[model samples]
Target: MRLAPDRRTLLLGLGAAGLAPRVLAQPRFVVPPLAPLRMEVDRITKITVCVRPFRAAGPRLDVERVAGKRVVHNYGHGGSGWSLSWGSAQIAAGKALEGGVKEVAVIGCGAIGLTTALTLLRAGAKVTIYAKDRAPYTRSARATGTWSPDSRVADAAKVDAAFPALYEQMARTSYAAFQTLLGLPGEPVAWTDRYTLFDGPDPGVTFPQRPTTVPDIRFFGVPLRNLAPHWNDLEPSQHPFPVARARHGTSMQFNVAELAHLLTSDFLLEGGRIETRTFNTPADLGRLKERVVVNCTGYGARALWRDETVIPVRGQITWLAPQPEVRYGLYYRHVNVLPRPDGIVVQYGGDSEMWGYGSEDETPDLAEAEASIRTIAPLFEAPKA
Candidate 1:
């Protein structure tokens, strides 16, 4: 999306609030059409951020002994499904590859399943995806496409043994793969700077922290009172709020709808087969061939596989009119103000928690959405009074 001088300048300039004025003269963003979704120009003065908690889905797939056939489990990626899918799928598929299988059944059609299927196809194997829902309907499309890791991947110890190393290797690989997609035909992948404002004493809390094993996770930690040349330090005159401290960093954002459609097109072009089928029970999977089965079902792993550990950290995002001028994103405390092409998605992640995560029988709560917008309205720079 193309940003106006005021929005772009304010964002980049604010990021360097403590720096010299000469630095502000540099052009920050190249004006581009808001395309595809057809967003319009608007001034945003505040934003919100939230913790999109991630949990495992259902019981772990019994790879040890699954009806005497090779099995690889690749589900349970919460909010990080699209972010971590490709890398995780590679590791899971590699495990399945050891059995010399030429055909595989991939369950789930979101980014994870799609990436897994693509990985298998590249590895000289025929792939078929079984799922209850496809792309736009899948949870993957609902994500705010940012390249931050560990947001929804399970905790370190909770993951399987082979998963750790595989997760690391796949994360690096996936990051590199996405780097290739940077500024593609659709500008599918792009970079944005975000500011996290901190006010008051240091209770010491942070977002989407990665488990002990993940690598290359970038974060800027600063004291609540420290003032420096960059975003961490703010002069008394530049302080946006009565804040004791704040932090800032570069973040990667992807257009989920465009990226998903691009991947789906690629999948079909490669002759990949997709079967729309939903499984109510593990036995329901018996209908498929006796070959390797890779489960990519996000929340469905619970009921279908009877996973009691799976929990739903319900998030509600309000789609307000788009603000094409707001190219950069803003995060303060737990609420994030993400500017998407479709609309401005204001999300609240911590207010409510639900159990049956995989259940598609859920509906959006409009009241929750309005309440969240109200809570984070103060963060926008030019919000409507």
Candidate 2:
């Protein structure tokens, strides 16, 4: 559901993120005290790695013919696969059904695949999803479960002229679709507050820039800037955080474990069918009876379609046991701590944006994960009376 915070009490976030934090000119509203978090390495529950399918040119959303079948491609969303699923699916679904085909095949059942299948089913198309495994077993489940629409989405200098508008439409469309899924059985998608604990007063100052030799990470225009409701400074007296400065903000996040189950139930309840199948090459898709196919294979497309453009940007999350009392997230020392229904995610992006660029290795580094937890441990210290 939308986060439970008064809209009027919250300051406009655009100013906090874009411009300098406003100095308080008036009396601030009362902020109820929150429970302290229990954080430590022993609380660790799991550690998983996900290699983002980053393409400097952005996602491939075009149609092509493969073995006499009209294959509509909808993969390569970098780290935004879960964030932009619905909008990207809408675009791919429309292309697959352009000839008014009533039957369709969807390859891969990750976030993008499941969403595309559901979109087609809603459009009066009988759909069958063929995949090696569903969302729970895929990389999407290992996501940090946050709304990062522009996280390595594209390189600003490399994208074509039309990509900016297309990216904007996709980001906004996916954002609107997410709003409809709120207040459902499970908080499959919801909002939460985030704090930036800073040693310095300015939260605008960012991590050191990556060198020119490495690939660039694009920080695109935030399409939902105005819609984000919360951004303000939490006075030191109102809270017990042990930091010199803190900036509070809010944004949408996903609990993919619950979301995967919810989407699967909805797809099956709507009379859609799923098959456990594998494809080695484009020719293998011809065996399927459906003439139209949507390829949502994600990073698997790199080997399956032999696409060299699908660069793998490795990401890993260190999960701490869930603490129901903790409903928010925070950032300190370039390490992120996001609490979700599944678990509390701890991740560290090294000195700059090139933390995981062009890396295909999926092995989780135990040392790196532990280091991230140690980085944010100070924030959870009990406040002295």
Candidate 3:
């Protein structure tokens, strides 16, 4: 979408003052040549649902003694489990190691769990992951897999004054961890150009302003536009979409299929053990024999630990055949189209930013998938001159 007037002015002022010479010297935006998508309904290979374990006050990273066991809670990352897995896991593993435990049990085998287990292993702890499902089968696999460290991460009113700074630290730490995976075999993680498209100019929508007394929720008080290395405003003709304006940026997109396999493989090769089991209650953790446990159960913590605060934000995605020629992603209206190695993920983010809160339904709605596809199908049509 078109940049807000104030944002445009700020960016222009920076360029005019020669403060951002490298950015100002770059060529004006143009849509990268991409193959037109095959949007037929029959091309859909799978439809998956993910219930994000959203906590209003942000992810619960505290430690608690449960049944005489030191349980380091690491879940409730909301929509950022994959995005901030490593950093959050690092925190959890550190807590587990506080007791000088040589062995640890990691609950859940999702992205967060695996990362926690790996981090513990790296720290010389013998780790075992106990879970009902591993990656590719876990809810983490259903994610659209984009790097959005602060997407609905927490509620403004619920978070404490220190939450934003903590979030920034996690974001930066996770970003650095993911960078190490680049160019590795299977291309588990790679950068992709992303565009946020709008049908017209700015909608003039503004968030209900919060009082200054509260900590600023704007990701370390820095606008997201400025966070991306390549944030640019594109004219109508510069973007492939029929939308009148677009905000383009580069993001790290995860190939979850490859990533899961790679992580699991590495863990096994590194002497980490994974057990296929599910814990029905918190007491079940005591049977593991590990004195310390890191709970990366993700949404499962709701029932396992009876954590009512871990509300589920339901998300569904329709996967179409992969388009190797299409390397970028786009967000238009409420729909997001992300091209991954497995397939092109078409997801509905809903109307308002707070859409799908506390939704637990996991059934895939074909009608909803079709509706979302219809919204972006026109982008494949010949653009107007």
* lDDT, candidate 3, 154-273, per-residue tens: 877778988877887777778889999999977899998888877732323222221222233332122443444877787776765666667988989899989888999999999999
- Comparing 1 and 3 on lDDT, the stronger one: 3
**Candidate 3 — which residues are off by over 4 angstroms?**
1-25, 200-227
Residue-wise C-alpha lDDT for candidate 1, range 1-385, written one tens digit per residue: 3423655466567668664343344343332332222112233322322223255421243364455446677776656667677777777778777758888888888888888888888898888888898878887777777765655455444555665555566567777678777887766777775556565323233333212322322221112222112344433333343345555556678787788888778877897888889888776666788478887776677667676565554444556777666676655545566766666766655411222233333455554455555555544433221
TM-score of each: 0.70, 0.87, 0.86
Q: Rate the local accuracy (lDDT) of all candidates.
A: 0.60, 0.82, 0.81
What is the C-alpha lDDT profile of model 2 across 93-208, one tens digit per residue? Answer: 99999968999999989999999999999999999999998868988878888888888777777888998888877888888988988888769988988888877322232333
For all candidates, the clash counts are: 16, 0, 0
Check candidate 3 and list the clashing pairs.
none
In candidate 1, where is summed lDDT lowest over 10 consecutive residues?
219-228
RMSD of candidates 1 onward, in order: 9.7, 7.0, 7.2
Alpha-carbon runs more than 4 Å astray in model 2: 1-27, 200-223, 382-385
Candidate 1 Cα misplacement greater than 4 A, ranges: 1-68, 155-166, 200-245, 351-361, 380-385
Candidates 2 and 3, the one with greater lDDT:
2
| Candidate 1, backbone clash total | 16
